[model samples]
Target: MSQEATFKSIVCEIFGIQEGDVADTKTPEDIESWTSVTHMQLVARFEESFKFQFDVEEITEMDSIASMKNVLRKHGVDL
Candidate 1:
């Protein structure tokens, strides 16, 4: 799958949401499963899947799916 699809799948699985529910606009404030602990878990999962670690700024700015994609891309993840 493409990086975008992989990202979406991972987010959906981590958030316990459906594929159709995953969107760029989705944020922690908008999703019930996106708690602090779960957010960290998601971050870890993303790092594992993409084989890269997010720095403090990247992690803090990843408040939404779109933001996460941007950060990943900035780190050389093709998406």
Candidate 2:
């Protein structure tokens, strides 16, 4: 699957939501399941699936799907 597809799948699984709900503009404020603990879980899952470690700053910057895409792109991820 493509990186974007994989990303949406992960987010859907993590947030217990449907694929249609995972949008680039969605943030923690928009998702009830996106708590602090789940946010770390997301970071771990993303790092594991994408094979890249995110530094503290990048982790903090990932407040939304769009921001996560930016950080992943900075790490040379194609999507």
Candidate 3:
């Protein structure tokens, strides 16, 4: 799968969202499964999947799927 698809799939799984519901606009507020703990878990998952370390600024800015995607891109994650 492409990096975009992989990212979407991982987010959907972590948030307990359906594939059809995955979208750039989706935010933590949109999912019942998304909370502080789950947010950290998702960050760790993204770090592992992308093989890159995120700075505090990046982590704090990860409020939505689109932002995360941009961060991954900025890190040159072979997308």
Candidate 4:
């Protein structure tokens, strides 16, 4: 699958939501399941699936799907 598709899948799974419910603008404030623990779980899952490690700064900056995409782009990921 494409990176965007994979990303949505992971987020949906972690948040226990449907694919249609995910959007780049969504943040922890929008999703009840997006707690601090699930946030790290997302980091771990993204690191594993994308094969890149996120530094502390990047981790802190990833409060939304758009931010995560930005950090992935910085790491040379296309989407």
Which of the numbered candidates is closest to the native, going by highest lDDT?
Answer: 2
Give lDDT per model, in order. 0.89, 0.90, 0.84, 0.90
Tens digits of per-residue lDDT for model 2, 1-79: 9988888888888889999888889999999999998899999999999998999999999999899889999988778
Off by over 4 Å in 1: none
* Candidate ordering by TM-score (highest first): 2, 4, 1, 3
RMSD of 1: 1.1
User: Between prediction 2 and prediction 4, which has the larger lDDT?
Assistant: 2
Candidate 2: clashing residue pairs, number: 0
**Candidate 3 deviant stretches above 4 angstroms:** none
Give per-model CA RMSD. Answer: 1.1, 0.9, 1.4, 1.0
Between candidates 2 and 3, the lDDT winner: 2
lDDT of 4: 0.90
Q: How do the residues 15-78 of candidate 1 rate in per-residue lDDT, one tens digit apiece?
A: 9999888888988888999999999998999899889889998899999889988999998888
- Each candidate structure's count of clashing pairs: 0, 0, 0, 0
Query: What TM-score number comes out for model 3?
Result: 0.88
Compute the lDDT for candidate 2.
0.90
TM-score of 2: 0.93
**What lDDT is obtained when candidate 1 is compared to the true structure?**
0.89
Taking the tens digit of each residue's C-alpha lDDT, what string does model 3 give over 31-58?
7788998889889998898788999999
Off by over 4 Å in 2: none
